[model samples]
Target: MITIKDLNKNFGKKEVLKNINLKIEKQDHIALIGYNGSGKTTLIKLILDLLTTKKGKIEINNLNIKDNKFNLKNICYISNENDLPENMRVVTYVDYILKLTLGRENKLTELSELFNFDIYSSTLIRDLSTGMRQKLKICTSLCFEQDLYIFDEITSGLDPVSKTKLINYINTELITKTVIYCSHILEEIVEVCSKAIILNQKQISDVITINDKDKFINQYNQSFDIGDLNHE
Candidate 1:
């Protein structure tokens, strides 16, 4: 579980987040939605300890983020941007990451098979397409077997088929994994997430559980004046 209280952040004199309070329980699949620059990425950074919070507290399973970062290894974060080493092969990269984070060297055959990724284990990261790299990122994160997974704009470059497969894997095989995904795609959010949090004005503007997703989505679209829901 993740608990955030009175969270506040500022860049120089400009505030990015203000007095944010949230509690995320285990097995909760949450979708963090917001326009660009609405503090979605900033909040994720704060949770990952990539940025310092000027005020408030963040705790993961009762361990304070500020004080117990080392103890909180049960978390995996996949950033929006891919930053793999240009010359490292896909398989080697996964192996390295697993060794660093999990202290074991196991082949990610299950993950590769799930994604239908055809890239050779010897192919360098720079040789892979954007979609392939994104698939690799997801595979690596899942292989870590962390309690909490964070995915930021993860489906940006995948085709419809690939995206569907990934979503199905997350919903089925990873049902017990706590996931917090951020995306501009509302349809994807409505389909995969059990809860939705809207970030606005530097704070969480709304928290909604999607019991009747189709109805909730229709109302949300009408309320926000966002023209025809665009899944692609």
Candidate 2:
């Protein structure tokens, strides 16, 4: 389980997050949702230990996040930005990632078929369109079966059909892993995650679950029961 206790973040004189405490259990697919500049990325960076925190504790299982004692192989992360190698071909890049994860090239073929996107083995990464690069990035992450998957705005450049297909693939593949999905696309969030954490005003405003399609209706304050989010 991932434990966050009294977690807080600040930037210069601005406080980004305030006293955040939440328990992320196995198989918990949480959607971290907020408008722009709500400290969403900052929070994720903190969880990944990309930034140092001084106020509170974040731990995976029993090991503190700052301690860096946990096995990194258990984590698979997808960044929202375009960070793939520039000079490599799409298929070549995927193949390289496959080697690192001990995955097969056929998995790329499968993802290509699923997303309806062509994977030209000779096409350079710089030449691919935004949506194509996004598809390739997603395929890179799919090559692994890591225990914890963290996705940040993964659906940004995907077309509507491709987005739906990717969501379906995630639903089918990661049925039992711990996932943290961050996106401003509410509909996309509802499709991929069971619970949605609304971050606002440097704090978690509500923890909502997908009780219905499109409308993630929650008529009550969920601040009291983070553990029961999936049940709702």
The residue-by-residue lDDT of candidate 1 on 1-232, one tens digit each, is: 9999999999999998988999999999999987778899999998988899669989898888877445556788886596778899877887677677554334356777878874347898998889888888877776776789888988878888888987887798778988998988877887789888878789888887777768767656644534532444
Each prediction's Cα lDDT score?
0.80, 0.79
lDDT of 2 at 5: 94
Pairing residues by index, what is the TM-score of model 1? 0.90
Question: Which stretch of 10 consecutive residues in model 1 shows the poorest summed lDDT?
Answer: 223-232
Candidate topping TM-score: 1
Model 2 lDDT per residue over 101-197, tens place: 6645687678777887666668999988888888888876777777888889888778988888878877988988888999866567767888888
Clashing pairs in 2: none
Q: Identify the runs in model 2 with alpha carbons over 4 angstroms from their true place.
A: 118-120, 218-232
Model 2 lDDT on a 0 to 1 scale: 0.79
